[model samples]
Target: VLEEIGIIFRDDAEALALWKEAGADVKGERVHFPKGLCRSLLKTAPSIYTQHARNPDRSVQIGGNATVFAPVYGPPFVRDLDGNRRYATIEDFQNFVKLAYMAPSIHHSGGTVCEPVDVPVNKRHLDMIYAHIRYSDKPFMGSVTAPERAEDTVAMAKLVFGDDFVENNTVLTSLINANSPMVFDETMLGALKVYSRHNQACIVTPFILAGAMSPVTVAGTLTQVLAEVLAGASFTQLIRPGAPVLFGTFASSISMQSGAPTFGTPEPSLVSYGAAQLARRLGLPFRTGGSLCASKIPDAQAAYESANTLNSTILAGTNFVLHSAGWLEGGLASCYEKFMMDIDQLGMQQKFCEGVDLSENGQAMDAIRQVGPGSHYLGCDHTQANFQTAFYRSNIADNNSYEQWLAEGEKTAPQRANELARRWLESYEAPHLDPAIDEALKEFIAKKKGSMPDAFT
Candidate 1:
């Protein structure tokens, strides 16, 4: 269907020209890929690649068995610690960056944890990119809202990583979402071109809400997903062969009754599983799934839904998991408590991915022998030795007895998470950026901001 019907490259002449030059059939803005063209082009895209962080210890491997968890992306509203929901500001954005940085289980500092509405729409990208650079040393993403914003992200990165390093290494992994139903608009295409030309990673994602943006059936949705991803990821190779790209998909089922999007459903999980296999067949990194929920608050409904989605994500062998933490209200709001709760689960997921242990200590032969049949192993030497590291302790859960819980004011999980978020932010410290590089970044941002009038829209 892709080869015959073709995908529309709406209003992107440069993209159309490139497609035409690459032997694709270009009719106005629609480009048709030959049956095997996309697959052949994908050969240059590396099956696995490392994304370098400013702090070398925090760098992450993007493919293979590794699964890197990132916080939520593109939420405009924030459910604050005080339980009030409002438009996110740069301060709120920085706070979430700090929380993500402090989260040991969160491997990547996600892009736009929440949209900073207080910052000018035209200039917020600078603040967002800088927040990741200054507040966290983890691998981070770049702007894809506009080509110029993407350029600014690259420029800021060059200041820290050096121009030569930026040109050669995979330092940034930006998201480029397809405008679904088989369309790639100019905004996304331009950003993909800029990032690919510089040898940075771009996750070519097709955002699909089943029954709306895509077919309702999982098999049908997966077909559209593979076609969109093949076309987009292969295009990166066309821009600059060997530029890293991931086969990304964001899927959710919509309520057939009201058309509202739903999360943590079986159909989306099935779509994720199928998409992961398709990505592997193409030898590209797979990106999908998240701790997604549709609940307005961090309640029981949120917990159940997020757990289902997060489990599916890890089981799918996803290479990069976006929205792994802090998502709430169907991706409309980023709740502080939910962010804390999600990371608590992420810690457990990380341990779960390690699989069963067969070592001498893991087998616990000593503990078993010391406590024969009816006796407990609570005070055994082996138990004492390994107790601390034996289990994944959750920071959010109140596992104490009912009496103890009541004595402690009957605090709920969200209450505990709220406290944790506050403590993390209060104790947050900025990562060390060289004074010269910091100054250069500030100058670049200032100059760029001065060049354009502030546009809120």
Candidate 2:
């Protein structure tokens, strides 16, 4: 397919040149790879690698058996505690970052948790990157809207981790979505080049809304997914051999009648499952799945859909899970209630990923023996010892008696989640950053912002 149709590297002369140098048949912007070109280029990609956090204890290992959960990315609007959907602000972005940091199950501080439209288009990336560095010490993603913004992210990362450390380690794992239908635009390619050259990780994903971006069939979508990822991931190797890259697939089934993207559908889950297997076959880390949904609010529809998608992602052996929490309105808005709700579900998924515990304590033979004939185990010695940490307790669930629930205002799940989000924000504290590094980052941001006229567009 690659040889016949060829992938177009639009408006990028350097990318075309690199493909030409690598012996690919470069025809203008349309470059057709030799049959084994992509696969052979993927040989240098690592199967697994560590994305080091500023707090080394928070570092995550991507690929293999590991699965990392990050918050929603690239949302322009947000649903607040008042349940009103509005344009997201810088404050909202920081709050979400703080929530991710506070939530034990959310492994990485996500990029562009919500686009702060109030901030200028050119300058928002600076604030967004700073928020991740300040509010959270978890490994986070870099900007991919532009190559210079991506370069800025690398520079700021250098401030925190030092030049040598930033150069040597994979601190940022940014998202680079393919334009789909076998196309790689200059904007994404430029960012990919900057990140790849610096040895940072890039998730080369095909952002496909099936029936719209690619063929409707799951198999056809998967084929397009593989072709796009191979082209994108392989191109990273051409830029800098062994630069960490994940075979990222974001394939969603669209509503046939309305032509809107639908989430938690069976077909997209199958695509995710198949794509993970394909990534494994190529010896590259797989990235897909999230608590995705099309609902505008965090309701039953959202819950059901997110569960199906998130479950399929974990079961499919996805290494890095983006949008694992806080997605709503088909990625149009980041709902606060949904964020907390998804965090609770993420905790459950984390426990599920541990698999069934088979150790003595996990088996609980003593508890079984103490409560023979299934009389009771609640008051038993083993049960008493393990009660606190025994099961995955949900913060959003109301398991109390009906009367007690009424006394507590008969709050719905969204209500409970709203309260939890409020509590988290109220008690939140920014992670400690070195004063010198913080100052350097501020100066750099100020200088950059001053250099460019605010480009709201």
My TM-score estimates for the predictions, one after another, are 0.99, 0.98
Clashes of each: 0, 0
Candidate 2: C-alpha lDDT: 0.94
lDDT (10s digit) by residue, model 2, range 1-457: 7888899999999999999999899998999999999999999999999999999999999998899999999999999999799999999999999999999999999898999999999899999999999999999999999999999999999999989998888999989999988999999999999999999999999999999999999999998999999999999999999999999999898889999899999999999989989999999999898999999999999999999999999899999999999999999999999999999999998887788889999898988888999498879999899899889999899999999999999899999899999999999988899999999999999999999898998
User: What shift in Å separates residue 393 of candidate 1 from its native position after superposition?
Assistant: 0.7
Give candidate 1's error at residue 405 in angstroms.
1.0
In model 2, state the lDDT of residue 54. 98
Residue 73, candidate 2: C-alpha displacement in angstroms: 0.3
RMSD (Å) of each candidate, 1 decimal: 0.9, 1.0
> Which residues of candidate 2, in runs, are more than 4 Å off?
none
User: What value of lDDT does candidate 1 attain over all alpha carbons?
Assistant: 0.94
Q: After superposition, how far is residue 162 of candidate 1 from its true place, in Å?
A: 0.3
How well does candidate 2 score on lDDT at residue 257? 100
